[model samples]
Target chain A: MTIRKIDIFRTGLRTFFIQSLWNYESLLAYGIAFSILPILIKLYSKRDIIRKGREYLSYFNSQPYLAAFILGMLIKLEEDAVENSINNNSKISSVKASYMGPLAAMGDSFFWWCLKPATLIITIFLVMYFNDFSNALFLLSFFLIFFNAFHLYYRFGSISFGYKYGEDGLKFFQKFNMNLFQKVMFQITFFLLGISITMLVLKFPFPKLVENIEIFKHIEFQIFYGISVIFLFFIYKLKRSPLLLILTTLIIIFIFSFLKEKNLVFLRIN
Target chain B: MIFKVLLAGLISGLFQLDQTGAFQFMLSRSIISSTILGWVLGSIIGQPELGLRYGFLFGIFFDLIWLFRLPIGASTPPDYQIGSSVAISSLILGISFFNPKFIYIYVFICLVMGFVSGYIGAWFDVIIRRLNINISRMSRYYWNKGKFLKFKSLMLLGLFNSFVKAFLITIVFLFLILILNPILNFIFENIPGFIVEGFAIVIFFIPALGLIVVINHIIKESTWKVLGLGIVTGAIIFSYLKDFHVFGFLIILFFCIIIWVNVLKKEKV
Candidate 1:
């Protein structure tokens, strides 16, 4: 017998909860393990088991954490449907497992390690710049939860799509590559980093300017624009190392300090 | 369990030290174990800050050891909890012994202790793997015999391994701290300011390494080039709005969103 839609959803949720027990390392390992169930079933189970197992495995593969929490749930689901040996299949299960591993790695690297930290760092810097640690922490927590929630939603949606479309759905995603989403995310990250760095540089003391204008008056926005252009040039044309860039910035800061000390240049702000 | 924790801590610390190449000689000269060994003694004797400072400094030397990925020879020490506990306990004992000078002697001792702990943890891992294999076989046997207890056993075994590792490592370090407190305090007092500052810089850079890893992953040629542009643009906007209070960032964020949604959004499409 074929696996029902509801059964697949229930199993996916169950797998998610179970997989959550494992720590980061264990979760990755287990996700791979469970994803291969279809292959295992194909090899050992009879024809009917192969079919049903393939259907179930496809749904499991699409779930978040690559259905890390769903391994046990998938196993349990298989056990429940054991009587319907007609629908259980193995080949499909293996295929799902094989695909999900790479997908999980991509998700884990992009979302967990890179984007999340970048967002949090930018937010934290802004908060600190504003002298609002409380709100910063709040925003930090919010983003963390928000990201995780999105992960869950995507996992669930993917799995549901799998149940409805099977291998076809997986193929579609592979073909499309979520390019649009990625571009948007990259843009967001770029904007945040750009603004935060600009603020940081402007806040650096401009002794000469302070003397003439009421230091805070007339908003010398041009300096920020100029510095940003310089930063862009360094990042683009020089392809300089972050360490080098940081060192250069520090050296510039020191030079500025030395100049101020020597009275080489002064800005008199009204 | 406590012994295991102490052992893991020692192992992690030793691994950290071993990674330091020649720096191990310096740590060897200065008594280091007292700070970490203090944890096992159930008293906060060693300076937690100092252990981290030294641990970080010690970490720089051990960079070569990180290639193996085994905690045995890595520059990054195991968790800080292990060293901190040991250090604290040692300081307490040093004060009690009336020979605070003895505290410095513990550094070398702690390094040795860490090495032994690494070996112990490695041995335990091997044993756990063997047990897992045996259990899997046993489960298969039971399944062949129409018995289902193997599944339950597997779950229990997995839980046991994770707990054991975490628990044993914590315990071993705590024990080391208890025994070595006296010598640690004596050494802690004599460490030079410059050495401390050097170590501090090392600690500060560790997170930067983590950042590099993240950066490398993000800056692939195809996807992340625009990230540079966004940063440059945002910086320019920020420089202009510096005096406007927090509202500056908010306004910047708003403009960014618009640029993202409209300009970049169209290009991507």
Candidate 2:
């Protein structure tokens, strides 16, 4: 029997909640199982239902956006199993394992690394600089909308393409260039940070730094660029998490205040 | 006491812990959680305005710091909810009203606690995942027995366990703060006044760390020259138009965009 549009749509919806049962043992294997449960139930007899469910319980993992590919392939494979057309159940696992790593890497780079950082930087900048809650909210709302919208598109795109290509959808993904998009974003993020660092330094009114405004004026732009260079080199060598690095800076300040100054207590600022 | 603990538990569990039922739509975020606690605590203390003000600031500030982390698969990001919750609760407790200046120390202490809690939260997830995997096993068992209801409930147990774990962690942390307040205050009081003044300075620089992460992620040795040249040109344009700051920034921004367009378009060609 052919898979219905309703089944395909329902399977797509199921992809959202697959992580509800996410466990370390099988990673997202259970979520994958749950997503395909409807298809398995419809295609298999009651006796074969448990067997099919157990099949998905094997070690399976991937980032959520690309999960549509796996779900699409599962639907096609289940249909074949139902018809007694293929006995090689290992084919499903092999295809899943093969495609899982690359898709996950792509998802991580695109969604987590590039898109999230950019959205967050914009939202944070709005909140910090403008001091306007509504502005940040507006940007965040637009970001959330755009982020989820693309994922939904990927869902539909992955399923349709996965169904059309069957196992070779893996090959289809290879033909698609995630790197070109990544490179463009990489440049944008780099450029934005340079601008943000300059703005941050210029706007901040440091008492000591302000006293030397005449001097800072001459080298103010250079100082901004200098900090950017220092920061880049520091991170390059340290390879420490950014938060941890900031925490260390905080620690250094705390210690410096006590050690460098005559005493722990100093004159209070208004 | 129970009410506050329960409230923290409910919000944290709903937002960060469970991450299901679409409830996370508003709860999991630092902004919402901090504002909720700030607003609620203010009402309890009859200082709603101040509570709301600090709550939003803290939320936004931490959200900036939390930007770099993205929870992918088994690699959970650090928990901002823990930090926000701890910060709000402690700030609302009474320190802000005391000297106002003393809140700086509390901010430092609470944030440190929050960071530790976040790591613990990640560890707790590992434990929760282990427990949930057993539910999957149990569901498989029930499925074998043809007990479909049992299978369904067993599957749902995983979701329930996440809530329970989140709820417990929040409650315990709340109480831990209450129990440890004396010790925390002692440490706070002992901290040097110079350090206290320096903290405000440190907070401003913290965002620099975030910018570094973004740039570090993007930098490739191959593109360094172009990246350097583009920014230097933008800054030169800004320096030339220094009188009107806004115009200078915009012109620089426009210059960057033009360069970006040219660069990308050239790549296309």
Candidate 3:
């Protein structure tokens, strides 16, 4: 069964609608669409690639919600290759299959898992703090609109770029140095998470007093920060595994829990 | 419309319990609840405003109960059906009698119901996970197949789980409604003050665990320094401005952009 462009678009749209019904599980449907549609689309149009690409772009641009739905559906679509190969003995290139999983993971973890959640959390906090219910509604609307817009633009861009650049796009990403991007994002997220943790621990009744405090007044904050610093120092100086640091922190927390229970030297307050 | 709203609410109630295995964080959002409920109950009932208000308020109350991780088992303390029923009932009352004042009563009923529903849901989880060995076996078998059958089975399981949870919650809510006045009087007569404070402390700590996890993930040296800088900058801006939403985000974003542009640009040069 040869796959036409209309078939691809319709399949993508149907998958998107079905996935939207469930929310988080929608990503699985999305991943399926991206994988199967591309393979199917490739078989139909060998010559009019540019024209087909333009048509796809226009279709997506005209329907932002449809675009977002398709992008989300692509999340589960990549798994099709793995399932098909295992079940039907169909061959998918190791490189293609291997890269797609990590790429999906990166997209899922970074954008959906981290960024979206963090944004929503922050927005909720802001709304609650300010008592701006209308603003909260606005923020929710903004998220839906913004994400859909990006999904629409990027879905077309990725497929078109993939078709036009072919192996070059794949090779470019394979060889591309993401260390700088990784380092910057890592630092920013780390900093935000740290400050959030400290503030949460402090939970200071008076904002003025927290503001006046020259340094970390909350002992719990100081303890966690100090432990984090020690872990960081060890990583830099001794080149220890990150897992070691995580284990050490957990151990310290456990010990702290016991110490507080035992009343071992200024551990408990009131 | 009433039937659809009931179906959606029942599904939502069950979804909250995670009984359905069909968890969508977005659907659980207060805005989505309001929008969906408003759409369903608005046109037919001619009470869109009430639906919007109660749907959101009840949703948030539901979320809060889940967030607090209240220990209510065997005997229902608070639950979602109570909230949904109260909200829906009040909306019905207001529309039928043309009395908007009933909305306040609706809100209070919903709050109490939310507490009850959450407890019942938790209890249901404990009960089902213990007793439903066949469900677990089915879940595992389908999970391994990686086929359409697996997906279909999971979806069916989700639907069944949700239906069961909703039915259980509805029963609990109905039971509570029958004994509401007496229970309220008993609570007013009995529970200690210090216990309330202890509950408050537990609630405070629950949300902090999420922050702790995020913090624990960033224990690297360079990241720590950057974090320190970000906090100091955030604090300073917050001190001057009082509201630091945009400022805090921009400061962090700017710091990141500068570091990345300098490092990558230098390497390129």
Candidate 4:
């Protein structure tokens, strides 16, 4: 029996909960079953549904957004199982096991590492440039829409494509070349970040003495700020905790401010 | 005041549902959620501008600070939502309740508290995940007994648990803020002006650290040359162009170049 449009829609909607029941033992196994239940219910009787659901109870995990594609392919496989009695559980298990790691890597790199940061850098740029509340709000709305639009398109498209093309739907991932996309995103983000850093440094309230020094006047502050960022980046590369860095900075600032208050020699900035 | 606290709790609960329960539409993100919370608080107090300022300040800090912490797979990073929500709520509520003159002190204290609360929230998140082991087991039990409805209900139960966790954390923090307001007010009165100024300075510098983190993430071996070009471009824009109109056009031009490059790449492919 062909899965109806409404059932497909229902399955797509249920994919949202794929992480709702995430746990240690099964790690989205139940969620996978839960997401595909709409299709399973439409295709099987009560006994068959339980058996099919039981098949998914073993450990399974992947990037949450890409899980829909796997679910759709799984439904197609299940349909084939019902019609043609293809080799049952092992095939599904292997397909899932093989796909989850690569898809997780792709989703994490593309969505989490690349896109989120790019949008954020852009948001910071716009907000800093505009420096207005309403504009900030409008920019924030842009962030949400820009992000979710791409998210929803892939989310729904993956489901439909996987269902339609079965395993061959993976060509979508191959065709996109996520690594190139990531490299491109890095370029854009780095450019924006450069601007943002400069803006942030220019806006910083330097001490009058520091600001007045002829040699330190024009862009010395920006240079110092850039060097500090590189220093901090190295500390981060050393796997030092951000909390530790913040605490150290705070302590140093607190000491300097205190000494300056005490009329320390040549250190007054406020 | 009680109504505001309750409303904040409700908002926190609903916004956090987007964390894992539903769409993952990034409503749970600190910047957006804090802004929305700030807007709501502003509306409640009849000073929308002040609220937005508070929200924007705290939101940017949290967003930038936690930008590098990716929640990939099973790795549960610090739950920044609680930290940001708690910080913003405390700041707004402290201002409303105590009417402290040294607002920076309040903001500073609230930020530290919020940062601590984030680690606490993540600890609780681990607990909740562990407890969900029992939940999945119960689900299996029901599935074995042919109780599909009950099995589905477990997922809703999981969602509800998440909502309740966020709500309870916010409510508890609100109460803590209420109890500590007098102490904080007293300290605010007694604190040295320089110390407060130092905190304000530190607060301003925190974002620089966050920027460092983002820069570290993006500036791989392949991208540094592009980043160098960007810095040069930014320096030119900041120094040469005083008019926003020119700046706006340049910004648009940059986006056009990005799009053009993408199109060129696609066509070549």
Candidate 5:
């Protein structure tokens, strides 16, 4: 008997909720088991159902998006088991173990670290660039669509492709070179950050730096840029939380600006 | 106000679920979550643009602050979704009653509140995860007993728990904000102009902090060459073109896309 496309689609949909039961002990174990239950019920006899389902109850975790690939592979294995009357439980578990860690790592670096922040910086630049708030909303939608398109591709692709390729699906992912993708994304993010910072400085020049509007006009950019770098260094090197640094800076700025407003003798602002 | 609070709570519940429960769609992201919160609250009060602006601002700000933190495993990052919800809802609700001239004060306070609320929300998140262990166990027990219905219910129960947790938190935070709104208004109104101006300054510089935070994440010795080249190119372009320079923006954006396509082409090769 062939596993229908609708069954795969159903499994794909279920994969979205696979992490719904995420807990400290078994992590994604229950969710994973739940996701494959429908497929298991359809494929296995009642007597073998419990035994087959028990395999997924063990601790299992993976990047949520990549879980689809693992599930697809599991379904394919289950299908083969049903066809050949062979228990592939051990193979399924091993396959899951093999893919979960690496996929999680790649997904974290690529999806979370690279794709997300890269798109975010671009969206932010657009948001800041466009004065119209509706345009900002449009950009936000673009950010969502752009990010999720890759996500759903991996998800839908993983399920279908993993089923098609079975264990060899790993080779398909190997072709992508996620590290290079991450590097390129980081480069784009860095480039966009540079533009974003320049635009930010242009938008909100330091009040003190802009004190002399005529003479210090061009110099303000350089000074603000230097200040941003210094802040970046402190953020990078500081052992404490960056949130602390931000709060402290806010306090200091509050004091300075307040004193300047009050026209204090020593720390007075023109 | 009741309608707005209820709506905020509902979406906050869904967004919270989006973060960890049903769908990991980027809906829970600060950029989207906060904007949705802002838009909803803004529309309720007949101020869609105001909602979008502040929502977008808060989303961008919070997203930058927490951009580098990844949920690689069981680790929970600060819950920016709830934070933005509380913050944006409070701002929109607060602005509804207060003088618009004093909007800067509201933005400043709400931002700080949002930042603080994220940590609070995360604290709750850790507790929720801990509590979910019982649900997981029960679901397993039911599954083992061949009570698939009970097992499914337990699965949904976990999601429901997450939703209720988020909804209650949002409602509670918004309630506190509503109660304190008048007091906050009076206090800020009585405060001298200089202090308010200082907060305005802080708000202006806040984006710089966010920009630097993100830049720091990408800045490394290995990537500095590309980064430096980008900075130079960006600097030249920004210096020449002024605000809303769509033409110049498009050119640089186009160049970035070309490089991206080139990289993909190389990958295909």
Candidate 6:
């Protein structure tokens, strides 16, 4: 019997609990095997089923969300293997394994690197600016449902493509441009980061900038602030980590703080 | 009390870090984890504000700090959810338990605990993932019989193991905090006030470091102008409109809207 809709749906849902069997040696191998248990059981009887399990329970990892696409594709491959009695076990595993790295790179960039922060920064902006704690729970829930559902929807769609065309379905990955979304979201996140940082600087005056309102209004101070932020851009350009910028800035601030505490404060711009 | 905290710990850990993540539904985020914790504590204390306010602050900072922790491939980032939950709930509960009259030092301790627990939590995750691998060999039995139900049963055994892992982490974290809290309180009471102020300063400064890290991510030649423009808007708001917080957020909001529309509009073109 061919795979039915109920089976596809069950496997998709089981994808969530996949990491329950996670281990370092094969990473998510056992989890992958577990997710496709029904398909394996139906396709292979007795020892053959055990062989399929053993085949899957070896070294697998990916961005978990994108793994759904891989899972969908693997189910189709497995079904094809049984239907044709093809000795394609190695091909199936390799196909799943190969897709993991690239999909992970894409998912990590799009979901982890981009969307995660974008939603977070948006939430921070809303909560802090309004200072309204109301619906903080609702907002969190809304975010959880929206982003998770977006990827899940994509995963369900991905499975169909994977089944119909096998490896060719990967070409569809190109049609989905995550870079543009990432760019826009990154822009907004940076803009808000600027605001949030400025708010902190103002809320907790950097000892030296505390003295005069006029000091900040000065073009020199504006330029100084601009340059400092641009310096952050440079730090990123050098392919240096963000942690370095934070440490350096913190050291700079601490030194200024120490100097001020010792009455070694410098002359004012005025 | 222990049971209550244990239950919260399980929910936080499982919800945030579930590996299979059905339909991509698990958030596994510090913000949501801590918020859920805070809301739980708030409901217990009959003070929604307590849960929400603390959750928001702790969540924001944790979100900022963990920005770098994108768990790609087999590599795992520090498990901020379990750590933050342990840290947040301990402090929130402390307020009620000790009936502390002041807030600042308590908040400072929570910040420090956040880092401490985050480190521990990350290590715990590594350990659990390592241990869970053992289940793979055992899954062979179910596989032999083509027993899909048995396979799911084994996976549940593994999922329960996850909760067990979380339980261990939370217990250790809470135990240390409890043993140290009294001595620390005494020392804190005796210490010079500036030291306390310094802690507060450091805690407040954390957001900036976190924010800077995020800004660092989007840096590119093309984005520099956008970056510059954002800084200008921010500085102007800082310099002139510090008091106009909402109006300023609106200004930023207005900019975001225009930028979003322009980008989407351009893509369509």
Q: Rank candidates by TM-score, best first.
A: 5, 4, 6, 2, 1, 3
Pitting candidate 2 against candidate 6, the one with the higher lDDT is: 6
Which scores better on lDDT, 2 or 3? 2
Q: What is the C-alpha lDDT of each candidate?
A: 0.40, 0.63, 0.41, 0.74, 0.76, 0.66
Summarize candidate 5's per-residue lDDT along A17-71 as a digit string, tens digits.
8878787888888888888888888887666777766688888988888888899
Regions of model 1 farther than 4 Å from truth: A1-10, A17-64, A67-137, A171-177, A190-270, B1-134, B142-146, B149-153, B171-184, B193-209, B220-245, B262-269
Interface RMSD of each: 13.3, 5.0, 12.8, 3.9, 3.6, 4.7
Model 1, position A240: C-alpha lDDT score: 32
User: What lDDT is reached at residue B179 by model 6?
Assistant: 71
Model number with the top DockQ: 5
User: What is the per-residue lDDT of model 6 for residues B201-263, given as tens digits with 9 covering 90 to 100?
Assistant: 343444555666566665677666766677688778778986786787688889988877877
**A-chain TM-score of every model:** 0.53, 0.76, 0.39, 0.84, 0.85, 0.73
Superposed Cα deviation of residue B30, candidate 6 (Å): 1.0
lDDT string, candidate 1, B1-269, tens digits: 34434444454344333212111111211112322233233223334443333342222212211112322211223332233333333333323444433332343344334434444544555455455455544433443443334433454454455345534564555555655554555555575533322221122222222233234434556435555665565565555665666576576567657755775557757
Candidate 2 lDDT over residue span A1-270, tens digit each: 778988888888767666666777787787777777777777777777776655677888887778778789878877877678666478788878888898888777777677666555555544444444334445446555655665666777787678767877766565656566556656655565565655455543222212233333434333533554475448545775645665666665565455434532232122
Candidate 6: where is the Cα deviation over 4 Å? A82-85, A202-270, B1-4, B7-10, B13-26, B96-102, B145-147, B236-250, B261-269
Question: Tens digits of per-residue lDDT for model 1 on A1-270?
Answer: 345555555545434333211221232233233333333343334444333422441233232444433343334334444545433445435654666566656665555444444454444344435643224335444444655565555555656655455445555356434555555665565555444444434442222212222333323323523453355344523653433533443344344334333444342211
Tell me the spans in candidate 5 whose CA falls farther than 4 Å from its real position: A175-177, A204-229, A232-236, A259-270, B97-101, B257-269
CAPRI docking class of candidate 6: acceptable
Q: State the weakest 10-residue window (summed lDDT) of model 3 chain B.
A: B196-205
Candidates ranked, most accurate by lDDT first: 5, 4, 6, 2, 3, 1
Best by lDDT: 5
Q: What is the DockQ of candidate 1?
A: 0.13
